[model samples]
Target chain A: MFLVKIYVQLKKDILDAQGKATKKALESLGFEGVQDVRIGKEIRILLDGRDISEVSEKVRQMCDKLLINPVMEDYDFKIMEVEK
Target chain B: MKFGVVIFPGSSGEGDCFYVIKNIINKEVDYIWHKDLIKDIDTYDCIILPGGSSYGDYLRPGAIASKSPVMESIKEFAARGGLVLGICNGFQILLESGLLPGILLQNENIRFKCQYTQVRVENNKTPFTGQCSKGQVLKVAMAHGYGRYYAPEDVIKDLNKNGQIIFRYCDAQGEIEISANPNGSVENIAGISNKKGNVFGTMIHPERSSEEILNSSQGRVIFDSIIGYLKGVTVNGK
Candidate 1:
């Protein structure tokens, strides 16, 4: 069996409203040189099946197929195998 | 099977959606009042949210309707892996309800465009769109004020990678196009679905073109896909 973790975020070319709010807050606190910051989250997938290799492949496919939006967001993943 | 369609006070597409899903599609469907809570959405197979000016788009489009009682049950159903589809205004509601992600913004050109637009299918393995093939393009009607879409870059890439970027706008020539990028939606997107692949939302009018009178024969397949999915479920017994 295998498990995966997926992380997604908006590209730098795009604006992040939440990040902007946070940046403004930090600036008010005297933190300088903070050009900008973007916000995103990671989805953890602990999948179980007989074929660990195939599940790993599906996890990557899921990232491309349903986990990330290629236009504005980029994604990365990690797969781990477990023994019964 | 009786499908539930929610009706907000200023909902514009109730009649249109009801006619298509009920009369044309020959399915038993009902309209649920927005004020009332859907006590048991698990009883039904599909739930639809029609386009509307819910809460008058006060703070933001769908910002208010996101908290409606009917939507609460819709959320429950979606959590249980039931199917739900939102259109235009409904798409906004989905975002606000957290059933889906991102927010709808004003049209980039700032024009109230009401016309036939082309869209490409980004996924095929869902309850609402089983019949649609990946990358298939279809022309549908679009009308809304704040329909632009926005989400985190990683979120966009994740949805695209996950095959969730349904209904991407295209040109009449079926080229990957973006002109009326309303609300600065990422990639000129018109619709999306959740990670579970059960919930879907779009800023288009499929019900308007279910008949030849609307000058397009593409919308029917959208509904057909849902029906197919429902039938499959009945056959499998959950």
Candidate 2:
């Protein structure tokens, strides 16, 4: 079995309003020298498979096709074996 | 002329479009549910994607609904040069489905804006705006949290060069000023069209402006323009 963790974030060039607002809140809370803050989404999936490479490819395809909007977001994933 | 308003689950604006077509404009209209296969999409003169929180705006507004079955038929209908109009949430779906250029970001103010605003007609030659004169202004209601339009710089340049920009938020007198732009869209863009001018997507809800009781009938001109184009009549004697 494998546990996949996917992170999706707005592209660097795209404006992240929610992220910006959160950063402002942090500043108000007295977080000094906080340069920048960006928010993203994390999705976890479990697959009943043994081949890490094959499952990785399938996860990438899933991200490209539906999990992320390529126009404004970027995504990355990590896969690790989980004991059945 | 026949009109079909697509109804995605959680979409709340289909009824407004249906009312505009059947009651205000007095035309043939029907609802196309999202799950159904639209085998006869070619029979309709125009397919409308109305405003609403489709699929509960999950995973980004309109993202889930964009991949629904009916959108495939919408894509085919658009490819065949049929008119497609998407308003508000509909606009987001069009973008998510790649039926239109650009993406809609959250409003700069990060608040849901719902009010009557003026939009200057940038291009009236398209089927959806035939009744409008170039530079004319129309009062329309915009209600959405994500209506700020964004595109690659090159795409913006191309859209400008090709006159695909159909509407811009403007002052009552038709000045495209930043103060009038409620959502911080690039160049105050409120709407745009595909290169072929057959597919249009706008953030404004024209259907909400189609009645005198609504205090604005200017929105009726959009529907009139579609009827006019289908009837082969030139608007403004053009």
Candidate 3:
């Protein structure tokens, strides 16, 4: 078994409105010296796989197919073996 | 001519599109459920992807729904030169489905805006805007948080060069300015079409403003344009 952690973020050029709003809220809470904030999504998937190499490639394909939109977002993933 | 309004799992605006098409426009229309793989898609002259949060706006507004089996048929429908109109959430699906250019992001202000706004007809030559005159202002209602239209600079230039930009947010008098832009869309763009002009997507909910009882029936022009185009196609033996 493997647990894949995927993080998807808007492209650098795209503005993160939610992140900006959260940043303002943080400022209102008296946080100081905050430079910037960018929000992204994290998805975790647990699946059975043959091995690390195969799992890595499968996860990448999953991200490319349905998990992330290439038009405005980029994604990366990490896979860890787990006892079934 | 027949019209089909696609209804996704969480689609809340299909009823409105169906109402406008059947009750107001007096046409043959039906709901195409999301799970159904339409085999006789050619029976319909136009297909509408209406507004509202589909799949509960999961993983981005239209991301999940764009991969549904119904969207596969929609893509096929569009490729065959059938007119497809996507409003609000529908527009997002079009972008996600790669049927249209540009992406819709959260509004710059990070708030869900629901209000009456005017959009100027930037290109009337397309099938969807033929009933409207160039520069004609339309009173429509917009309701969404992720309505900001964006694309790479080169794509924006291509859209401009190809006359794919169909509508721009504008004042009542047709002045294109920043204040009139409800959602911080690039270049004040509110709507656009594919290069072939058979497919269109817009952030504005024209169905919401389609009736006289709504106090702003200006959106009727969009429906009228589609009906006009379908009629022309029929007359031309298509």
Question: Chain B TM per candidate, please?
Answer: 0.93, 0.98, 0.97
Worst 10 residues of 2 chain B by lDDT: B229-238
Best by TM-score: 2
Give the distance in Å from residue B75's predicted Cα in candidate 2 to where it truly belongs. Answer: 1.0
Rank by TM-score (best first): 2, 3, 1
Tell me the spans in candidate 2 whose CA falls farther than 4 Å from its real position: none
Expressed as tens digits, the lDDT of each residue in B29-134 for candidate 3 is 9899988999999999999999999988988899998998998888998898999999999999999989998899999998899999999999998888888888
lDDT of 1 by residue, A1-84 (tens): 666777777677666656777788899999999998777768887888667677767777766544554545777777777664
Docking class of 1: incorrect
lDDT agreement of model 2 with the native:
0.92
Q: Write the per-residue lDDT of candidate 1 for residues B28-113, one digit (tens) a residue.
A: 88889988877766678788889878878764577667767787778888999888889888898898778888877556555666
For candidate 1, give the lDDT.
0.78
> lDDT of all the models against the reference?
0.78, 0.92, 0.91
Candidate 3 residue runs with Cα over 4 Å from true position:
B233-238
DockQ for every model, please.
0.02, 0.72, 0.82
lDDT of 2 by residue, B30-59 (tens): 999999889998889999999999989999
Worst lDDT run of 10 residues, candidate 2 chain A, spans A60-69
Check candidate 2 and list the clashing pairs: none
Q: Residue B181, candidate 3: how far off, in angstroms?
A: 1.1
Ranking by lDDT: 2, 3, 1
